[model samples]
Every structure is written in C-alpha cells, then in structure tokens.
Target chain A: MMRITRDSLLSGNANRRSWMALVNPSASELTQAAATLDIPESFLRKRLEGEASRPLIKQERLISLQFQVPMPKKGGTGQFMLVPLSLYFVPGYFVTLSEQEIPFLSQLIDPQKPRKRWELVLRIIAEVTRNYLPTARSVAREMAVVERDLRQAQRHDVVYRGLDINDRLLTLDLGLLQLEYVVSEIGHFLPAEDAVLAEIHEDTRIELSQVRDQVDSDQATINELLESYAYVVHNNVNHLFKFMAALIILATIPLFIPGAVAMNVPLGNFPHWHYGFTVVTGGLVLVEMLTAWVFYRKGWLRLD
Target chain B: MGCQFYDTVEDVWVATERYTADGLFLLMPEQVHQCPQLEAALQRCLEQRLYCQDAEITLRLPVALLAQDAQFGTVGRMTHLTLHHTPRSLAILGEEPLIRRLQQNWLGELRHTSMGELLQRVLLSIIYSHERVARVLVERLQVLRMALKTAMGNTELRQIVALNRDLGELVIALRETGLILRNALRATPGESPVYPLLDAALREQRRIEDGVNLIHERYLAVTNAYNGIVQNNAHTVMKVMTVWLALLMMPIAFIMPWHMMTPLPLEHWHYLWFGLLAYVFGVTLLFARWARKHGFFSM
Candidate 1:
C-alpha cells in the first residue's frame, strides 16, 4: 500500500526520522545511477528483472546484494520480485539504492522502534526467512486445490488453472533455489575477522542456513506431491483415451454390416421378389442384433 | 567325518577347528563371559574334535587362554564366522575347497536366493543373541535399501516402481560385492555363499514377487471394471437403433410396386409407370425417415 516516489527518497528534510521511497527507475536512470555510483551497470539491471538476486558481492568497500522478497500475503498471485540493494559504508555515510521501494526500511525507521542500520539488515533477513513458510504453504494449498479439481473431473476451467498452478510451482521452485544459492554465498562472508562482526555474521548464517534447509524441505515435499498429481493426470488421460477408442471401435461395427449388404452379393434372388426384400431386410436386422449382442458380451458396450 | 555340534547360542551352531600345537578357542563377546553356559559351550567346541580346520587361525583368540576378568561393552552385533582347522596344510587344501564348493553349490538348490539369504543370516545372528548383529546387517547396505523400498509407497503402481528401483540397486550391489569377495578370498581363506546368506536371498526374492503380484492385480481390476461399464451402455444403444430402422422402413415396401403396375402398358404409361413409382417412393422414404427421427417405432 505504501508508494514511495524518487522525490521522497531524496527529500532534503534532516528532521524526518522515517520515510518510504518507491523508485521505479527507468532504464536510463538505472544506467546513470550506476555511472554516478561507479558500480557495474549490470548490478542494478540484473536484480530488477529476476525474482531474486544471485548473490552478494563486496568490492572496494561497497557491498551489493540482490534479494527476492515476498510480496504481501494478500498480494495477488503471491509473487516475489528480484530487487538489488547496494550499500556503501564510506567513512562519513551509508546509502541504500534499489530500483523499487524497500519496505523493510520503514519498519526499522518507525518512531517507536528505532533500530541501528546493522540491526535492521539482520532483522530484514530474519523477517524474510520467517515469511517463506507461510508463502510456501499457500503454494502447497493451491496445488491441492488443483488436484481436487482434477479429481472432480472439472476439465473445462481446471485445465487452464492446472497449467497456471504448474507454472506457479515452477516459479516458486526457482525462487527458492535462487534464495538458497544467495544465502549460501552470503554464508562465505561469515567467521568475520572482527569479533562483533563474527558474532552477528555467524548468528545470521545459522538463521539463513535453517531457512534454506526449511525451504529446501518444503520444495521437496511440493515436488513429490506434484509428481503424484502428474500420475493422476496421466490416469485421467488414459481413461479418456479408452472411452474414445471404445466409441470409435463401437461405431465402426455398424458401418461394416451396411458395407457388406451394399456389396449386393446375391441372397437367393430375394432382391427380385415382391415382399422377399422384407426377408433380406429381416436378415439385415438379425445380423445387426446378433453383432450387437456379441459386442455387448465382448464388453465393447455398457448398459450399466 | 562325524558332525559335532557345539551349541553356544540357542539358535546358533558353532564348530571349532582343532589346533595341532594347542586347542584354539573362539573368543566371544565379554558379556558371554558372565554367562557360564556360553563359557561351557566354548570349552566343548575346543575339547571335542568339533572345530573346522580353517577356523583355527582366523578365530580371534582371547587375550589369554585362562582369560582375565574385564568389563566389556560392545559397539554392535557380531556375525558368527565359521573357522576351519586341519592337521596338516595338505588337509586344508582339500577340506577348504570341498567346504567352499559345497556352500556355493547349495545356493543353487535353495528355493529363494536374493536378500532372503542375507535376512536369514541376520535373523539367525539376532536370535542367537550375537552382539553387533544389527550393525553387521546395516553394514551390507543392501538390506536397508530393500527395507526402504518396501516401507514407502501406498498405491500398488507406486510401490512397484519404488521397490523395483530399490531391488535393482540391491541386486547390482550384491553381484558386485560377490565378485569383490571372490577376488579377495582367491588369495587367502576363500569365500562362498554359505547357508545363512542363501536363506536371506530367498526372503528378499519373495518380497519382490509379492510386490509384482499386487501391482498386477490392482491394474487388472481397474481395467476390467471400466470395460464392463462402457460395454453395457453401448449394447442398449445398438438394440434401440436396429428396432428403429425396421419399423420406419416397413411402410415404404407396401406402396412401391402397386403404384408402378397400374400406370404401365402404354407409351405415356411407360414413362408414367416409372415416374409415378419414383414419386410415391420419394414420399414414403421421407415419411419413414421422419418417423424414425421422432422415434415413433424405433426400439
């Protein structure tokens, strides 16, 4: 709900403690921002596009991080976006740059709960980790819903929804994989040379590792259930195939008898007789009945 | 040769090979030291000429023949290995090969020969109250793989797939290990598929067969049921269609020849005969079709 513009982020009010900035940077602005900051142009470009950033890299006292933050719970589609955040710790000041507004900063800047910048980053990562479980559960529930629709044979709408669910599941799986990959990269920065930094980094490492593990576990569970559902879909397709095949084979039987009769292989001059045509017709009727009865017994037809 | 049984553990059969210098004693776990019965059984294997010749040097001899008192705890279960001894080195060459060949040949006769042999061996070790029996079984990895295969999957198809993959791994591992064991023993004491291992192989084979049967039955029943339902519906449809055509076509026959005969025998009558007949035939045909469509007499 909070929409922060570029003007708000650059607002020159020293007194204001907290603010939200939505920075929908155009391609040129992003390029210019990278030029002014002297960072690689790809840094901002990459994060802005993907669901999550690849990993954090530190060069020349500047740390650039990419994160895939989950949208709000009520956010339609439950998608996450890739946002690249770069931090500069140049002696006098610190700066955060992102293509979009960062919500975590607002929580840190809240008047009642003032937090140091270092504490805020840890808090942000922790909150992101905790939120993954619920988001994953929602995806699982969505899959179950699709599975139920399949069971009910609701092919009309669910065919599309099933496709959507499959796509969503792929998206979620990729997002989690990227998140874990980034966390593992960040983990390498731990065992800090400085004591305080080490303590903080180690604790964060454990938290992130646990989150990575939990997400991986959930990913596996979702995949297994999806495989089972795949089998169900396969079974349904086979059922439909059997039905169609039976119908085709059944309908073909009547055609064969008519074809033989039309061949006009003489049946004792019955065709020339006045009402002898009735006998031929009667024979045709008898043939159809007998063929149908055989078909019925052979289980090509179902009265039940 | 006479068979001598040194019944140490209740379910276990132990044979001790005789040493020419002094009788060799098979060392058991420390817990058995407390059980006077197992101690007495160990003495019986040494005293009676019951030990196989190859068993003499291979059996782990105690710290001292008299045995000092020590508290012992075990890391895991123990698998009882048969040891053989011979009076001379020549006796060994002849006896060991015969023992090896006998064990190897017996495997072919055993009704089942997969993990059943391994399971039976493990179970026997457990029933004999051998220490580290579970660990010994676990070390093989094949048993655990087979157990996991059986443990998972609810539906017959899923279970069959799971079990097949597991059993495939198990069989491959066993074959590879058997080759490794044979190569290792070719230089020394030698190896064979003894009775116990053969028994376990049979047990696992049975499990595989059961899984296969379950999957077959499940597939057959579902297909049969589905076919029955579809067939019955089609028969009812065909019967009604046949009856419909017969009723509808009956009226066209009665009017066809009567109209044609009356108009013939004159030049105009010749054309009129064919033409009138055709007109009546067309009208009758249309009426019959309409009746058939409305189901006036169909079925």
Candidate 2:
C-alpha cells in the first residue's frame, strides 16, 4: 500500500510546480524518488527503514533531514509508537518519504496554498512537533480513567489498567524527550541568514518545550496514581485475610459442643438420670450464648 | 436576484434571498460562478462543511472564507449563517448577523492577527463547547457514584450504561475534532499568532478529554460495585433462610426419637412432657446461638 502524491506550490495555473509526498513507499518507489530527486538511495532507504544512526541535517549536494514522529497504533491498551520521516530538499521542490502515511504532513503542504520550499519544510517540522500533543493528551486521559477505576475498586483488572497506563506514559515521555532534542538540533541547523526560518525555529522550540512540560506533568500524575493503587490493593487483601481468620475462629467454637453431645460422652449425669437431656442441653446453650456474646462485643463476629 | 450591499460604517456584510428594509443581500451559492476566486472559495467552504458542520475558517491565499451557522429557538430550530473574511475584498456569503458576530467576536478582535490565529480561536471555541458538556458529564458521574454507594437499582444502572454510551460518543467526537484542529494549526506558519493560543487550547482539550475518560472509568467501577452489592444481598438472604431452616429442623431431632416405642424410660415419668418441652427449648436456643456466632445474623 504505497501512494505518491504531487502537490503544487500554489493554486494558480501559471506557476504550479509540484512537490512529491511518498506514502508507505515500496523499494522501487524509493529508488525512483532517489533517482528523480538526486538523493542517495541509501539515505532514502535508511530513513524509510528508520535506521538512522543519529538525527542529522546534512547538506552535501542535497539537503536531508531525518527526524521521528509519533504514530498511533490501534489497540485498547493505548501505546505510543514512533516512526521516522526523512525529508529531502531538492531544487525547486521538496520530497518527503515515510514508511507510513503521515496525515499531518499532507495537511501541512496543501496543494491549493502557495508556500516556499523553506516554508514547507518549516511547516512540516512545526506540525510534527505539534503531533505529540494529541498523543500525549490521549495518554493523560487514559491515566485519568485508570485513576478513577482504582478509586472505585481495587480489582486486579483495575490494577492492570493502571500498569498499562503507566507503560503508555513512559513510552510517550521517552518519545517526547527524543523529539524535543531533535527539534532543538533542527533549530540549530537552520541557517542564520533566513530570518523567517529563525523565527519558525524559535516558535517551534517554544511549542516543543511546552509539549515536553505537559508530558512530564502527565507522567508524574500517572506515577502517583499507580503507586496509590498498589498500596490500596495490598491493604484490601490484608483486610480480607484478617476477616477470614476471625470467621474461622468463631465458627469452630460451636462444633465441639455439638460433637460431644452427639457422641454420648457421659460426663456428670447423662441418660441414666431424670431430665438429663434438659440439663445437658441447657448447659450447652448457656455456654454457646456466652461465647457468642463475648465474640460479638469484641467485634470478631462482624460480617461487614 | 436580491439586493446585496455592505455596511461600510459597521464593517458588516449582509446577504439575503429577499430585499430587507435594513440589511443587504449578497450572492447565493449558485450566483458566484463568474468570479473564479469566489467560486473556488465557495468550493473549499463546501468541502470543509462536509466534515465540520459548525463555524469554520478555511484560508486559501488571495481569499479567506468564514462559514458559520446559528441554530436559534427551541423546537424546529431556525439556523442563519454567513461566510466572509477580509482579503482582497470583503466577500460575504449567507446571512448577515452571523457574519457580524464573526466580525465583532473573531475577525474584528483579531484584526492584527494572522489567519492561523483567527482559525485557532474558532477551533478553540468549538473544542471548549465540548469541554463544557464534558464538565456536566463529570458532575453527573459523581452523582451516580454517590448513588451507587448506598443502593443501585435498575434505573441507576441503566443511567450509568447510558452515560457510558454518551461518553464514548463524546470522546470519539472530541478526538476527531482535536486531530483536525491540530493538523490545521500545524499547517499554518510557526510564527502565526495562534501558536501560543494553540498550546493553551490543546492543553484545555486534554483536560476535558481526561475528565471524560475519568467519568467513564468511574461509571464502570460503579457498575461493578452494583453487581457486588446485588450478590451480597442474595448471599444475605440465603444465610437468613439457612438459619431459619436450621431452627425449624432442630426439634425434629428430638421429636423423631419419641415416636419409637422403645423409649420407655421417660415414658413413666410424670413430668415427661415438661422435660421434653424444656429440652426442645434449650436445643433451639443453642442452635440459634451457634448460628449467630457464625455470622448468619450478622448482616
């Protein structure tokens, strides 16, 4: 599933030159893009495969930038997955290659709008930085859900949910940190001559820093919630064990008297004397009542 | 064809199907074909409307368009809307008052702002509308949680289920809208005035999303608690029934023995019936005590 789309710089017909966006490119498509854009096939391949040794901005014959963007995966557990996107700045046009369809890229480079090559590049970086906000926001929401669930009940399912959210928050935090560093590096790579690029870099830096702050705050919140949930679950289990022990102690007290009476153990006066059944039964009744009253007053007989 | 005009003093544009005594009339959707620019703007507006039904600003260079719909009144609501912005000229389409409000609230206040800034304000307003609804839902969730703590009937459970459904829908809608807005903000220039506002709005939207998700979690918890309460109630009923059965059967242990003719020892006694009565009473009392001690009557 690969798509190559050509977007024009402006809407008018006179100066409608096209830039290429390759979505989920195949090997042959990558080679074609490399040949047409005069970029090295290896550079294109490495970026698509996300095999870059480090985030870099190189200007040999053609300018190239390798950065990562967080892509969402479809699942209930809410995970943060990052994918690398490589950009090649060819003469009179720009090319973007990614293993997956980056929807925000298409939005940034609208065919109907007129944008310079540098403007498009800057927009792409800005958009990629903003993309983290939504995913981070989602993770925060999932954390809140887990926190609420823990408040309602300390069940294993809820505990697992808290752990799951914690994992997500950690993944998001790592991604955001890496992105912040990449963005900073990109800012330094921009030429000092272009004031527009400099301004864009500053704005992007600010936005990225804000995003990092938000991620850190959310991570802190999720960590706190998970710790509290663990403590609550442990306390609940201890209480349950104590309640069961009390129940066992109270239940065993009556079994002894009943067993002795049924076995016909002749202690004082049994069936050999008149009213023997009455005297024996009455004595057992008094003992049972007194034991129960004592246990009740001591709070061991409480069911709730 | 109706008369169309712009209020130069108020900087408001009016478009209507019929000539009005006070306002002006602009070109309808069908009449703007001659000017290719206006036609293109209308086409873009229509495309945006396909996804977002409310007010939106779609900026295409050489022209920027604003479309809004106002749903007023209670039953059979009447909607009046207008679309316009300042670029080459004030090209206003649709109703007048909607355009005026857009001018005074968004465009006029943000005159020095970039298109991205104006668009961000619009998007934030839309997102905040959902936030308000989410706040109400969170409050309702708290009420439901309180109710479930004591007793949860079928009605309350049904309400929780309904609320869950609503929250699911709300979350989906908000997420989709948020994604769209984020993409839009990204496409704009980084130096756009909306950048800071975008950060704040995104933060607010995140908070709302968190609130909704929390409510949903609480709803599930309350439901599970309700089921536990029901099961506990059933167990209590069974426990009481078992105690009663034990009490009723206690006398049968002694009564069955007396039916035998071999019981001749106590038969000659004068107070044999009284002794049997006392024995039965003592055994019943003992059985009750044992039952009580075992938590049969604890609840």
Candidate 3:
C-alpha cells in the first residue's frame, strides 16, 4: 500500500493545505494511491511512464506539470543531466512523483518556512533553476579555456574541447528554451495563486533570465568560434593554391616567349656564326629574368 | 604469471620463498592454483562481503570513447594489474610492464608501513606515471602543431601519423584502465584515503582524455593541410616541367623538319640528318622512359 502522508508540508504561512511526495512507486502502488486520492490512475500513470513532456496543465480539473531538474551523474564525474519531477495538482492539494531524489526538497518545503502550492512550486523551480547554474557556468568557463587555447599555442586538443563545449552549450541552450516556455506556461496556468509565490517568482525569473542570457551568449560565441576556425582552415588551403598558381604563371610566361618565337623566324646568319647559340640563348635568358623581376616587383606571388 | 616476492625486511626483491606471509609481493595473473595467497585473498574478499559476487552496475561513460564491461575482472589483456592485500602481505598483479615499472620505482628503506599507506603509494605511482605519459604526448603534439605552421617534410608528416595513432590508443587505454581502476577501487571502503586519490586520478584521466581527443582532432586537419601542400607542390613542379618542355620542343619541331626540307647552309646534310635523327630518337626514348619511371605511363 502507498503510504499517504496528509501532514501539511506548507502550513500557517501557506494556507491550511497538504502535499504528498511519491518516492519511486510501482504501478500497483500508483494505482493504490490514485484509488485513495479518488483521481484517475491513468493521468498519474501517463506522467509516471511517459517520457518527459513539456511542463503543462490538463484542463480536466487535475493540473499537472513535469519539471526537469538537473541531477549530477552518480560518482561525481562533474557532469549532470535533467531528470523529471512530476507534480499533480487536484483542487486544493498536490502530489509529486520524482525519478531522482530531491536532496533539498525537505529543507525547501519546511513547515517552518511555510508555503502554498504556487509558492512551493516557485521555490522548487527556483531551486531547480539554480541547479542549472553550475553546469551552465561551467560552459562559460570551458568557453574561456577554449578561447585561450585558440589564442595561445595552437591547442590541438582544444579543437576537440571546443567541439565538446559547442555540443554542451547547444544542449543546454535547447533545455533552457524549453524551460523558458514551461516557466511562462506555469505562470500563465497558475497565475498569482499566492501573493508570496508571485513575489518569489519574480526573484526566480531574474535568476532564470540571467542563466538564459549566459546560455544564449555562449551558444552564439561557440557558433562564431567554430565558423572562424573553419574559415582559418579554408584560408590556409587557399593561400597554398595562390602560391601554386603564381609559380605556374611565372613558369608559363618565361616559357611562352621562346615558344612563340621558335616558329622558325629568320635567324639571319646567326645559326652559321660561332657565337650564334650563345647570343640567342643569353638573349632569351635576359628576357626571362626581366619577366621574373617585373612579376616579383608586382607582388602577385606574395602571401601572408 | 611473473611473481616476485618483496622481502619487506631486506627492502629488495628476492626469489626465495623464505619471506613470511607478512612480506610484500609483486604478482601477475595466476595459472589456476599457482598462488594460494590470491585464492585466500579472493576467498577472504568473498567472505568479507566487500561487493556482491555478481552484482554489476553501469557507470555512465562517454559511449563514443569506450563500451567496456565494468564487472572488474582483470581486463588489460596481458597487462592488466590488480592489488591484493592478504592478512600477512600485499601483492599487485597483472601488466608485466607495470609490474616491472613498479619494481623499478619502489621506494627504498623500511617496509613496516601500514597496508593502506603502501597501497596508496602503489596506486599513485601507477596513475602518476600514466598521467606523465599523457603529458608527454600532449607536448609532442604541441611541437607538431608548431612544425605544421611551416611546410611539412615526409619526416614531420610521418611523425604526425604516429602521434595520431599513439593518442588514439592512449585515449582508449586511459578510459578502459580508468574504468577498471574505479571498479577495483570501489571494492574497498569509500572513506579510505585511496578514494580521494582515485578521484584525483579520475580527474587527471578526464583531463588527459580531453587533451588526447583534441590532439586527435588536429590529426585530420593537419593531414588534410599537409596533403594539400604536397599535392600542390607536386602539381606545380609538374606543370612547370610540362610547360617548359613543350615550349622548348616547339623550335625543335619546326627547325628540324624545315631545315631538313631545304637548307643551303652546309654540305653533308645526310650526316646532319642522320646524327640529328639519332639525337631526336634518343631524346624521345629517354623522355618516354622518364615518364614511365615516374608513373606517368607504363614502359
């Protein structure tokens, strides 16, 4: 049997209301809980079993929101991922189902602190949004490292790291965008159900916007960095091609004049003279040198 | 199954079985029942309920890097190592090079230290050396990056290829070895100072992995750039040779035929034609031979 604790997690400061936390329940347990609550089992089960959906409310009296909270990958590898925290609102009370432990939930929803449903959610969202900062800020830090790597001694490794940061920021960017939509929807659905929640939600909104702004800026910077590096690679290849083209032109010009004159124009008696071959070959070389000098002075062959 | 007994009192490796069970030992994989001590440690571990005999949990790792089994069976092919501590003695097994490396780097003097302290040193020695190798590889890649700024020779190009292969292998080995180490280390208590050391080692391993991956990325760009350089240089030289050769031959083509048809400059025109014909034939044959040798055409 699923134990239902009706003790008020929010009381005195919040209205005289209660919420239940379902910590890792089975299908039968869920059904049992739904039977006790007199709510449809399928509504709760859809959230429990279905993959994470955007935070939204169903119109059939029961309001539900699936908020994803960032949880660290176990063993503390300095990496984290978003896991769902499902909340079901039925009239005056709410029930939560979580896939991961909320370490700060007990402290955040303390009876001493006192909170209404919307106030509780505002605090929860604020806390969960705060969890995103470490990973989000780590991206900014990694971005700086990458920028430094790119600027300094060519960090062949940062190229790989830059790609990782690019991917990480892109993922965070998508998650935050979805969350922004969800946060706004929650505000719309619940409205200022609690004056305290509205007041607290303002604080959460500022923090959210700050994180969102950082993510957006990081995403843009990563895109620009990747593009600039691509352009660098392209420019290197193009520079080589230009050098080759110039060398070909240099060779071609010197070769062409002799080729055109070799059409057996009158050599006069030059072929009969002892110095004939020398004079003609020397004259051709002199013309070639002059062509080379002119091309060199023109700076068409130079590259940065 | 290379086994070396470290006589703790003497502070040196010895072949004799004279050392007590309290002495330290260096060991590799056993040949079934070769070392009763391993069997004892294994049984003691099983008795201690250190970890379930078969329970396995997947540690989320970057799938692109490794997809290795984490069940903690000695895994480095022939070079995998494990440290075993019996009631009376300690031993490290697997990876002959690592075993040899450990033996070479052994701290001299007393061996009356606690098992935990000795084990800490042994594990640190392994990880520290591993991290050093990664650092050296990174330096070599740095040198290569600088070299790539200029034109590359066959030697430098070959070095990059070698570095690419080495870094790729290191990346795989580091992760696999890291996984094995984690699985092995977790068998011990969480509060052991070794746990913090393992964490540090893990952090270093990640840094090294990131560095290796970045260096490996460079391989593709450098290879492409260098290949372009070689091809472009070859193409330019070939173009110049072909253009000049064709041009130089233009006068010969016209002069040889025209002068032969009607030339009143000298007698012995037959000798001139005969010698010139021989020369032209030799040049044609030589050019054909040169082209064929250079793979422009078959002989």
Model 2 deviation from the true structure expressed as Cα RMSD, one decimal place: 19.0
Off by over 4 Å in 3: A1-5, A11-17, A50-54, A58-60, A74-78, A91-93, A148-163, A188-195, A232-304, B1-299
Taking all chains together, the TM-score of candidate 1 against the true structure is 0.38
TM-score, each model? 0.38, 0.46, 0.38
Q: Tens digit of lDDT per residue, candidate 1, span A1-304?
A: 2232222121112222233232666777767656655666666565556422224545564665555555543465544443444443222233455665667666544545544444445565666666665665565566567766666331223333433443344444444444555455555554445466456656766766665565445544544454344455445434434433444444444344433434446555443455543444455567657766776676554412
The regions of model 2 sitting more than 4 angstroms off are A1-17, A74-80, A151-156, A193-196, A257-265, A270-304, B1-299
Instruction: Return the TM-scores of chain A for each candidate in numbered order.
Output: 0.58, 0.78, 0.65
lDDT of each: 0.39, 0.54, 0.55
Expressed as tens digits, the lDDT of each residue in A160-252 for candidate 2 is 565456555555655555555556656655567878878887888788888878876876665555545655544443343344445444444
Winner of 2 and 3 under TM-score:
2
Q: lDDT by residue for model 3 over A1-304, one digit each (tens)?
A: 2334454455324445556677778888888778766787876776767432325655556777776677767664335677777877765456778766678777776655556666677778888788878877766676675555443222133444555565566556555655565566567645545576666767888888888788767656665565454444345334434544554554454344444434566756544665544454456567657766775677644544
Summed backbone clashes in each candidate are 45, 2, 2
Per-candidate DockQ values are 0.01, 0.01, 0.01
Q: State how far residue A25 of model 3 sits from its true place (Å).
A: 3.2
The reply for model 1, stretches above 4 Å from the true place, is: A1-22, A25-54, A59-61, A72-80, A92-94, A148-241, A244-266, A269-304, B1-299
Model 2 vs. true fold: TM: 0.46
